[model samples]
Target: MAAVGNRLGDATSPYLLQHADNPVDWQPWDDRALALAREQNKPILLSIGYSACHWCHVMAHESFEDRDIARLMNERFINIKVDREERPDLDRIYQTAHQLLTRRPGGWPLTLVLTPEDQTPVFAGTYFPPRPRGGMPGFADILRQVDEAIREQPGAVAEQNAALRHALGKLSRAPDEGGASALGNGPLRTCRDALAASFDTVHGGFGAAPKFPHPGGIERLLRHYALTLTTDDEPDRDALHMACYSLRRMALGGLYDQVGGGFARYSVDEYWMIPHFEKMLYDNALLLGLYADAWHATGDGLYRRIVRETAAWTMAEMQHSRGGYFASLDADSEGEEGRYYLWTPDEIRGLLDDDEWALVEHRFALDEPANFEGRWHLHVQASFSESAKRLGRPRDQVVALWESARDKLYRAREQRVRPGRDDKVLTAWNGLMIAAMARAGRLLDEPTWVGSAEQALDFVTERLVDSEGRLHASWRGGRAAHQGCLEDYAFLLEGVLECLQSYWSDSRLRFAVGLADTLLARFQDEDSGGFWMTADDHEPLIQRPRPLADDSLPSGNAVALRALQRLGHLLGETRYLEAAERGLQAASGALARMPEAHASLLTALEEHLYPPEIVVIRGNMEATASWRARALKYYTPNRLVFTLPPAARPPGLLAERVAEEGAPVAWVCHGSTCRPPARTLDALDEVLDQSGGSS
Candidate 1:
């Protein structure tokens, strides 16, 4: 085959590189591409999608690879390709533009036609076939029509540009009076009511089919339960129940890999039995922390098991050798979805002995009809307790048999062709995973996990972050490209903070402060009181989007707010606090209207309303370790723990506090007010009790 590459041959993003061989003259999202569009007076056809997106691959094959469609695109437009993961800021702007233009939710392989004059989007949509199908016009036809319209109806395009600008202005501006003085518990109540209304009683999770794991909402529920648990309120208990039930169902369902470990992108069914089967690093990372927290809250062994398995799976499969995590695993294997994961009853039977098959069949609902395209997506149909009782065997025996069967199955499945892995390391997603590993490792006493997190953080610092203390969005094949967005700083700052708790260092603390500074300088909307998705120096788009609503992942603005607040508390920086206040104020309106949708921001608000108690333990490493163990015994979300060694001279909150020469001394402090140092573990408990730390 002759080289048909245009500009994507040198791209770092695997998604863009995948289209390098396409006949279409694809260019990266850059100043050069935008300038070319303006110079040539051609419409900019921006196609945004990620590596793992199924429809993205379909469109690439059907249209981009087609010589006829490619010719039309190359001739009529300054074609640009974007990996959404690497440029979420661009994705957010265009996706919102698409929503405004079409009045429909925008998704992957987003096809947008923008005017060259202002780079204003005149038309937008998702995937379109090469030829007409399902009542939608063909990609080629759309391109031709858009080109003709741009040339012939310049006035109409100008009108759209003006209208879109107006809408964008309205959306970005802060409300008068900034928001309610105090949002209070009204928003919390609204969120609770909404979750209750949408809650699936039988199968768990919210809404209907094609369910996504709303980890942020689930965390809110858990926090809500913690807040009102002692009140003996029905709402509080119900919130906890819903969260627990949903988590339990997801863990047991096919969304969670039964044979292997880690979760799929989402389940395509309401029952959580059939997943789309793509494994993403971000999904598993968030779920790891969620399950770890659940275990801490309820002491559920199942949640513990899930945390262990998921973390293990992440390390085994998703993690890169050097340290950072990979982006995602594709949904298809050998051109068939779920081929790597699905198994038939006969296959299971052939793999297992008679006794093992009997237990496995009953446990996994093999007796029922196949639910996943004539194949069984293994889900726990019966609980272990029930299985033990039904099989007339001891619970321990049943567990042993199940473990044996799963090990054999996993080994056998490993021999099959695996799904394609998107090996690009994304800073934001890695930060999330790092936070998960750090927090879980600290709480669960898994040093290895903590080491993994540290290594990844180190990798990011050395490779992803450039000199002048700026972060890059993606790293692949020793090449780092694209300036970091708000998410990159916010999430990495979060990871640094979390990792600091597990194991502290002066360099890491400095790095955190640098990120916080960069966040404020680059992304903060100084006037509106919220952070913009893109930086001040980012490529000029139609609008600077400051989206607050939590999407598939938590909103970057929300994360920034929370991260800033946490940093403020840790470092005693009034600037961080002020910035966080502004962010909260900016978000107050959306939170007031539909708090359920702004779950991540609500979390930030919760921390703001009730400041976390700061516990600092100072002494020799051995003594402080003992004190740390005592403090971590109970599950306390509203507490920050720091075990400082004598050699360490901490700054900010712990700057004043010094190590007393003797056994470790624990000081339970809230802001500047601190009680006398507690010399013993018992004394520390007493101090904590008086300070309302135990509650």
Candidate 2:
């Protein structure tokens, strides 16, 4: 039999590298490992997790790092470790299989024992301890049980594997009957109603404890409110309140870094008082745009402050000097979760004067019981006005003192051991951030943020795309690896479109066109409808997922459909539009069944039902810039505003909308129809106000 040592030493993924020194003979999910497993007639032990996963780290220390456990793992099975971020394809397949077998939702550190020949999962679990605890089987016990099953009950194992394969196959196939003709507002309304029902009236956000930001759902609510605002319905107003309230609560909670600027993954409690602590690029990216839109909708200064601080934190800490954004920040620092972020009353008091300390104590609830392990993780327990009233100080004075105290605390926090950052630049995540930065920059009038987006776009185009124009999923330490997935193409296409709106670039337009073409050619499910998560030429896996529901990030299929619809309309390409409609048809059944779960797709469906309004401004560069800025003042979810210089030659439908005279002229098109060109800012405003409350 072929010998296997720890083969993850040469892996590009930081998550994989973290396990390189483990005693377990951990192999990266590769053909060689699979071949070895088959040859040895042993089941494949597949373990999947990402760098920021605290449980993944716990499993590694408790079991993978133990010599006796490693010995058992090496002797009984061919162990494969996958960084879920680096190989979401594998992660998705196994995670789904886990759910099917266990009848429970799957999570990180997913443990599965697969059939050697076909790689079908026969056993599934997650986060096994060193010894059995809390009714969970020990890692060693599970490993032995799996080995024994394969050896002594081969027929039963094979029977179960066959059933799982059939189940997975069923999941991959979309409903045959639903099509564009069946698509309607039922799902859209259902989604809004569901969100409203689950929304915590007092605390904000949806559901109970362990609250995720669910930015997609929040954005759905915002768009729904905008769409229905003209009807003057109380539910529409309530939708707006839900979105704004959730945004406010999250910004003020421990989920946000009180000392820093970025957000943690999610709040552990209903009140948003404690968080899981890992900071993800995708979460921030999605939330950035949400806050910007919220600011536009309500003109809330708090939303604007969140946008500024979060954007600053992203550029300062998460971005690579080469321009691409990094993947995530680990939940742990100094071997404990939330350690780097937590502090005592003494720490705050030492950093500020008596007045500042008093204000800080009340503002962040430092005087109250410790929220996390007897060390306070700052969350807004009282507003400035309330603190001002209680302390007999002016509100303005309280605010100023709080700011000073915050800066001091932040500076002091910087001196501590920081959480490890996963520095790999992922194309899909970078795409999300690019779109966020571009849109937020334009909305907030931050030119530097726009520049940052452009720089990141340039880096991805230069470093991640191959000679044949295919995108690499990830890049780090001068190497780009792994075939780009649907999200990589779809998200980047959306990003490119956003960048063009922020600052028109001819090369970027070409790039966007190429991405759209690639999606149609390489990723689209022509026979079924929605795009596959992997390209047609991707490495064969147990199953090819066509995901339409939003998870931590928005669904790739939904993003692809949205991007396609937008690009199709902008470029006047019927092919892209048709594909998007087909995708909506494919996802129609799923959307109807669980609309809230498919919030991202609900937005796409809304656009499909009511095509987005596209505004093209052409004239002298300086004059057109003013018109473009004016048009963007409102949060129009179903609008795309583009400005072009007189000398510029735009492609596709935009090519026909030429610059007239030396003055600015705006042409607004809804669906296939165009309104008369508006000559002045007043005329433009009148035209827009007539269009009113989004689509």
The model with the greatest TM-score is 2
Model 1 spans with C-alpha error above 4 angstroms: 1-5, 178-180, 230-235, 691-695
| Tens digits of per-residue lDDT for model 2, 1-695 | 44589999899999999999999999998889999998888888999999999999999999999999999999989999998898888888998999999899999989999889999998999889998999887989889988898889989987888888888999899886843347888898899899999999999999998899999999999999888865444437888999999999999999999778989999989999899999999999999999999999989988999999999999999999979999999999999998999999987788799998888888887778898998999899898889999899999899888788888988999999999999999999999999999999999999999999999999999999999999999999999989999999999999999999998877788899999999999999989788999999999988999888899989999999999999999889999999999999888889988999999999899999889989888888777777887788777889899887777777889888876676888999888888999999889988888887222
117, model 1: CA deviation in Å? 2.7
lDDT of 1 by residue, 1-695 (tens): 23223899998888988999999999998778888888888899999998888888889989998999898888788899999999898888889888899998999989999887677899999999898999989988899888898889989989888998889877877766855456566777689789889999998899999899889888888888876743444437788899999999999999999999999998888999889888999999999999998898889999999999999998999888999999999988888788999899998899998878989999998989998888888999998889899999998889889988999999999999998999999999999999999999988999999999999999999999998999999999999988999889999999998898888787798899999999999999888788988899987777888878889888998889888888887778989989998888878888897899998888888778766667878888876787887777766766778777677766787687776674588888665467888888889988877755465
Among residues 3 or more apart in sequence or in different chains, the pairs in candidate 1 whose N, CA or C atoms overlap within 3 Å are none
Q: Which regions in candidate 2 have their CA more than 4 angstroms from the true location?
A: 178-181, 231-235, 693-695
Candidate with best lDDT: 2
Whole-model alpha-carbon lDDT for candidate 1 = 0.87
The CA-based lDDT of model 2 is what? 0.90
Question: Which lDDT value does model 1 have at 580?
Answer: 94
